[model samples]
Target: MVESFHEFVVHRSPALCRTAYLLTGDHQLAEDLVQTALARTYRHWRRVRDGNPEAYVRRVMYHQQVSWWRRRRLVERLEAELTERADTDHSEATTLRLSLDAALRQLTPRQRAVIVLRYYEDLTEAQVADALGCTLGTVKRHGHDGLRRLRAVAPELVDATAERSTR
Candidate 1:
């Protein structure tokens, strides 16, 4: 537990960046997201420092990513294809990671957030809902839809036979 805002940031920024990267798929955007969230957290540090500051920062990042997605909707850029040489021996895990990244990029912002929170962050449906400031039903809907889409886009990444948990 960090007592100061600076210490909190130093300890949590890497995890925040990873979450932001999972949310945005772009490194620059991820950095900006974490920075924006941290700035907001700093503003309320006096009030939030003694509480769950990391959760507060994550909530801010998720909300900010959604807002940024809305603004970028009209001017979304065409991403360049990932190129791989046949001669280069790539590990299966690396291939899966790349595939998952691409698959995640296809989801809507809310769905992507749901997926990242639920799986990458190991957050439960209730936790995801709280983080996104949404209902549990909304979280469930997005998670279901997102998983369905991921299976369609990258079947190798998501198992076809796995059942969605009711919890």
Candidate 2:
């Protein structure tokens, strides 16, 4: 069991850490979050190993993210970092990616989590709700609210999409 768990962690850790980094936008904090979540998951391995352990760890990560947000006022500090860089390379796709990432950083942690899970991970509403331990309605509300906020902040994206449609 220990060997199997170790192997599982080795294989899944990168993806988990990537998700954590996207959720937090801080490498050190993401590492801590993933480590903490994995540790907690390890404690209940027997019960969770057979089930969707990835979902269990993701839930732990989401809860830990929320708790961290509540406990610290770090989001304000992050705003400056989010806007500090503007992608000015030749690649339009890279610029759009950077712009979208910056826009996502402006959202609240829960809203960001909802957006990441729904869009990046392409999880269904029920899956997102289950992962976040929220009701499906809350998941839908968060997704709606997050997109609304993103649209408000990123009118350029909307304009770009409109231009594409017309062309």
Candidate 1: list runs displaced more than 4 Å.
1-3, 74-89, 159-167
| lDDT string, candidate 1, 1-167, tens digits | 23588889889899899999999888999999999999888888899888788889989999998898887785443343456788876876666677878888889989999999999999989988888889999999999999899888878765522432322
Error of 1 at 20 (Å): 0.4
> What lDDT is obtained when candidate 2 is compared to the true structure?
0.85
The global C-alpha lDDT for each of the candidates, from Candidate 1 onward, is: 0.85, 0.85
Worst 10 residues of 1 by lDDT: 158-167
lDDT of 1: 0.85
Clashing pairs in 2: none
**Sliding window of 10 residues with minimal summed lDDT for model 2:** 76-85
Please, what are the lDDT tens digits per residue for candidate 2 over residues 73-130?
Answer: 7644323223334653556675566667777888888899999888888889999999
Root-mean-square deviation (CA) per prediction: 4.4, 3.3
Q: Give candidate 1's error at residue 44 in angstroms.
A: 1.1
